[model samples]
Target chain A: MKNKKPELVTTAATLEEVERVFEAGADAVTLGHERYALRQPGHFELEQIKEAQQIARKHGGRVYAVMNALMHHDEVGELAGYLEQLAPHVDAVVFGDPSVLMTARQVAPELPLHWNTETTSTNYRTVNFWAGKGASRAILARELSLEAVLEVKRNTRIEIQVQVHGMTCIFHSKRELVSNYVRHQGKDPEQEIRAAQRRMFLKEDNREDQRYPIFEDRHGTHIMSAEDICMLEHLSSFITGGIDALKIEGILKPLEYIQTVVSIYRKAIDRLAENPHADIDSGWLDELKSIQDPARPLGTGFYFKQQIY
Target chain B: MLTQTVQSTIASPTKRKKPELLAPAGNLEKLKFAVLYGADAVYIGGQKFGLRSKAGNFTYEDMKEGVAFAHAHGAKVFVAANIIAHNEDFEGMEEYFRTLYDIGIDAVIIADPAIVEVCKQAAPHLEIHLSTQASTTNWQAVSFWANEGISRVVLAREVSMEEIRQIKKYTDVEIEAFIHGAMCISYSGRCVLSNHMTNRDANRGGCAQSCRWKYDLFEEAEEEDTETPQIGKTELPMFSEEDDSFTMSSKDLCMIEHIPEMIEAGVDSLKIEGRMKTVHYVATVVNTYRKVIDAYCEDPEGFVFKPEWMDEILKAANRPVTTAFYYGSPTEQDQIFGVPPKMAKYDFAGLVLDYDEKTGIATIEQRNHFAVGSEVEFFGPKRDNFIQKVEELWDEEGNSLTEANRAMQKVKMRVTQPVKPYDIMRKEKK
Candidate 1:
């Protein structure tokens, strides 16, 4: 039997964006409430979530609820009810903290779980461990090299997801390090400081060539990569490797940019699905560059280079 | 096997077990010192499959010796194999787990679920304690791991006292928490700054501590400049100039004043971090907490916090201390900017090797410089610290010496008070 094509997944902030990305050839869109999700383009309320699911169904696409927060005790009491309300509306729930699993089992036993512990989802045994706990899929950490990713795929029977494009978060602190720094400067932080607009960057003391984008929200401060990950040229390894999904991180990207990127990946996956050994499409790279932020260059992140000290 | 019967208000109405004092041992010597200093259990890393690769990690022989020593002293030894493993990294882990089990270690602290599975299958008797690197924060996560047969879960440093109390109320699994040590600015195992900037994987024992590195913050100009800004050469105003640079390093966690609160929270283990710290640090921190925990468990109703314990820890602290996330969220005060060298209030003078009570001559091994007339403090695990002035010194060959300056040099001194082996002598900074 021919291998099934991996689902092309991306994030959406609005119902219109959900409709647009699905129209642009994405197979699924992920969104959730501000309280339950970590970094997302925007949070959707319960009503909006149902509407997005409806839109996905109309377009033959899927909806994934981002229940990926490392939950606190105060947040635990609200999870059961949230998952109960969220059960019938989405296809799967992507989570990092296992508390979601415990709560979901009690309130929504039928809801599927996709484990994404951010950076700790490195090896295949752990992937299978989550699969034993009934996770339908596992999102691999972006820090894995291509060789390691293929190895994990070869070893695990569960469906797997990999980020093929866009900004990758390098650091996340539950404390408001940025706001605390603002207060330490003796100035009240302007409301814009907390916004995820790509306006704030960190430069190392002596090394001046790199800029790391940083911002603060309810999940606390997040520092993103100086270069966005663009895996358009390497779509064949994942396609032939029998991976289940290819995710384009659309957390801070504009809707138009996300649509274009999703279209590029969608076409690439289709081409590779038809012909596993295919030449690079020069036009696709050029199209991504035209829409990507000039300040943030695109690189094949951790796919080739070993990130070691 | 090392258990203590103390008190816990949240776990049960009966007299609950007191929390175990867990200390870090980078090597065999540190392990012995930690056990002698009253650690109920000590965690160490082997030369493989662990973080803190820079430290003097134990070999299999060292682990066997260390485990024997700890068990003989009524303490337990735990090996940390907490690296977030990749595929190739799993090569020898099963055999490593079997070897650790054969050595009769109390448990293995692991973060990777795959490795936990390997340990369960290869060495079925070995207990598994989840590493803080897993960042387990809430009770449900604890329950999830418990269902997976994890005996203990180390609560993330981000967890609050109230959260811990609630977690204990709901879950019967043992909970471990960090009470003293440096803290990661990000959620443990949730950061890759080192990998991005320096090509070092922080989750896999190659942490360069990139978070402590200083950075310059800038506000990007609004409105797309037709000119794509050059990476760092732009004319953005540097907001961190006044302090030289911006740093996100957090203050060290210290709970010397909150012993009763921690005990009442039903924490099974109170762990001290810093596997890369010095022997002096292990001794000082372990000795201080040992005294406090003993005092509180002995007289729960009348226990009073001691200022001396805080003073003792300050001698070895590198940065200021904060009760991180215990009371609530940490603020500006909890962060450290413009890195300062490790605080040096006292210098380790020597270690007592042997003492002749009749002759009043103490044999010592010099760690740092100390003169004949230098005043020093002698302290032991079971004895009160006493101050004495060095009147004279002699080399091992019986040659009279004015000072012991050579590192690890054997010196004989006329000590007024009787001192035992493993006793520490430190001098105030001149």
Candidate 2:
């Protein structure tokens, strides 16, 4: 039997970007609120999230709110109230912390929850565990190989999402590295380090050549890969592997970049749906590569070669 | 007069159960010393499926003997099969659980819920303690795991004292918190830095400790150069004058002085953090904490903090100690920034392998240099430390020796008091 094409999921920062993604043929858009999300610049307020939800619904698309932060105790105390206000405004909520799952189940048991704790959901059993715990969809870890994803799909009925583009997060820490560095330099950490203005890079002492970009916010520090993951050529493998959605992880990116990447993936999925054995055209790959930041390189990432650290 | 009477009544000592003093055992020898020195429970890793993969973990035969030895000493042994299992790991898991159950392991510590379910099926008789790698910081999460049949939950180190008190109020599940040891820069153990950088899966057991590595931060230049920028380009250093430092490495955790508060908070276990330490380390740390916990239990109402316990802890600590996230969020001072060298006040001398009461001599395996006349302190599980000059020394072959300096060298030393096999010996640092 021929496999169905996976839905194209993209991220948006603005109301206009939401419309742009819908026009570019995205089936779903992931939006984050300012207080609960890790991304500082792109997060929307409650009213903006409501508008984005309306725009998504008008275009026959869904909006998944990104609340995937490793919340502290006080932060968790604020979750149920926020989730109560947000339950009616969005289609589903994506989260990483287990505490968030329990809180969401308590406040809004009817809401759909997506489990995407970066590196935790690597196998079918983990997916099954989360699915049994009330998560409707589980995003597989980025470190998994194609065969591993297929194995997860073979074992479970829960929907799975895989990242198809954008820079991958290599490290996540609760310690605010940039603020601590500012304090180490004899400056006031609060005054010197502004979350929205912070842009830092770190390189190993031994390997001075490769540098990874780091983002710090109220939540914590997130270090991303030097090269963005571009898996345009591997869409068929993911689609046939029974992946339910293909995610493009650049909510803070430019609107033009979002539209371009979304359009390219939309065409690729359409091509694959028409002909299961068809390969992504070379022209589409070049178009997808053109939207990436010039400073960051592009690679196939762990999709082709497994990282061994 | 009425207010004074009420205050005195509140200050009176009340009976409370002693919290478990749990220590880490990287090997069988460390396990024995930890149990003997004062640990109520010792957590050890088997040959596979544990976080400390580099440690000299116990084999099945060694684990059986270690459990027997710990039980004989009235201490419990919890085996760590706590790695986040992958698809390939599930093949031998049933056999592993069966072996652990057959060997009489008190409980199995796990991080993955799938593994918890596996244990429920494979070894229904065994208890399952949730590892801190689960990052459980709230009461609802604890309640969730408790409903899932988890007997205990190791609260994440980031949880505050107030939060712990509330969690205890909300749930009946046993709560374990880390009282001493190294801290992860990430939340719990959910980090991929080692995996992405070195290809070693931190979740699977091969953590390269990338957080401890020194890194330099730089800001990207705003203006583009006339020359085309290349990928992986080496930019000029932003803050070059500053020393290369471990921006992410945290200070070691020590809560020896806060024993009364922890006990009052209803903590079920106080866990020590090292599984890759020496037998001397296990013995010293366990003994010191045991004394502190016992003293607090004996007089909780009149408890006074002791400075000597801090001094004793410094003898075993290689890094600066901080009460990490216990009071609240850690500040800049709690983190170790610059790559400074560690300072220790004492050096491990040796372990007493056997004692011959007839000759009034103890057979020792030397770890550091100790001469015939040097003053060394001998301490054991049930005995107070007594200083004695090494008046007589002999090799295993019975030849007279003036000094023992070689590593793992067997030597005999005459002592005034009887010594057991796991008794530790140490000398002040020169």
DockQ of each two-chain model: 0.64, 0.56
User: Listing candidates in order, what is each one's chain A TM-score?
Assistant: 0.96, 0.92
Give the residue spans of candidate 1 off by over 4 A: A1-3, A190-198, B1-17, B224-235, B238-240, B339-342
Candidate 1 residue lDDT tens string, B122-218:
9999999999999999998998899888999999999999999999999999999999999999999999998988889999999988998988888
Q: Worst 10-residue stretch by lDDT in candidate 2 chain B?
A: B226-235
Query: Model 1: clashing residue pairs?
Result: A308-B199, A308-B200, A309-B200, B6-B18
Query: Candidates' lDDT values, in order?
Result: 0.88, 0.83
Real interface contacts reproduced by model 1, as a fraction: 0.83
lDDT assessment of candidate 2: 0.83
Give the per-prediction TM-score of chain B: 0.93, 0.89
Number of residue pairs clashing in candidate 2, backbone atoms closer than 3 angstroms, sequence gap of 3 or more or interchain: 5
Best by TM-score: 1
In model 2, residue pairs whose N, Cα or C atoms come closer than 3 Å (at least 3 residues apart or on different chains), thus clashing, are A308-B199, A308-B200, A309-B198, A309-B199, A309-B200
